[model samples]
Target: MVLVAVLVVVVVVVLFAVVDLGPPHATTNKAAIPNRLR
Candidate 1:
């Protein structure tokens, strides 16, 4: 029972870390936009 509890905690910690490293939103993108109008 103790081992299972530890395993669950470890998994939860890893998932939290993964969420922190997820892809950023549009505002976070630094690339400049191209204008199509001539």
Candidate 2:
């Protein structure tokens, strides 16, 4: 159970890192989403 908890934490950290360093396409889509909603 402890190992599973550690793994989940590590995965969350990696996901955060990837999102922080995300590619331009991902950022563009995020921006475009708001405009599309309007």
Candidate 3:
């Protein structure tokens, strides 16, 4: 139970970090997708 809680907290922290770091990469991917389709 304790281990599960720790894992959950770690996952949440990683997710927040990803979101904080993700916008630029996400935008680049979004822009690239249209070019790829074209």
Candidate 4:
């Protein structure tokens, strides 16, 4: 049971990270994201 819980948590975290790092092509301010991140 514990292992199953850990797997689910890891999967969710990975998905979140991927989505966060992906480019937001829908917006016109594509260059602004990296500047804000720095």
Candidate 5:
């Protein structure tokens, strides 16, 4: 059915979004924000 197809697509998109593409504890450089951004 059309409804079933749409549901499958939605579920696939949600699963893809939840997939992690990197290590959980990875760190990155932090940059200081300008005064205007605070």
Candidate 6:
């Protein structure tokens, strides 16, 4: 149970990180605008 909770937390954190890394919002810096389009 403890291990599962830890795993879930890790997955959620990773997903949040990935979402931030993946989105190309217009508010991001101009330099990031280039590559963030991917």
Best by TM-score: 4
Window of ten residues with lowest summed lDDT in model 1: 29-38
Better of 1 and 4 by TM-score: 4
Query: What is the C-alpha lDDT profile of model 6 across 4-27, one tens digit per residue?
Result: 999999999878656756665556
In model 2, where do residues sit more than 4 Å from their true spots?
23-38
Model 4, 2-26: lDDT tens digits are 9999999999987765576565454
Total backbone clashes of candidate 4, pairs 3 or more residues apart or in separate chains? 0
Tell me the TM-score of each prediction against the true structure: 0.54, 0.56, 0.55, 0.57, 0.51, 0.55
Clashes of each: 0, 0, 0, 0, 0, 0
Over 1-38, each residue of candidate 3 has an lDDT whose tens digit, in order, gives: 99999999999987865665555485576676566568
Cα-lDDT of candidate 6: 0.71
| Tens digit of per-residue lDDT, candidate 2, span 1-38 | 99999999999987865665555476576676566568
- Runs of candidate 3 exceeding 4 Å displacement: 23-38
Q: When superposed on Cα atoms, how far off is each prediction in RMSD?
A: 11.6, 6.5, 7.3, 6.1, 9.2, 7.2
Once model 1 is optimally superposed onto the true structure by TM-score, how far is the C-alpha of residue 16 displaced, in angstroms? 0.1
Residue lDDT tens for model 5, 1-38: 99999999999975653453222332321222232235
Q: What does the lDDT read for residue 12 in candidate 2?
A: 100
> Which portions of model 6 miss their true places by more than 4 Å?
23-38
What's model 5's lDDT at 38?
A: 57
* lDDT values, one for every candidate: 0.58, 0.72, 0.72, 0.70, 0.50, 0.71
Worst 10 residues of 4 by lDDT: 24-33
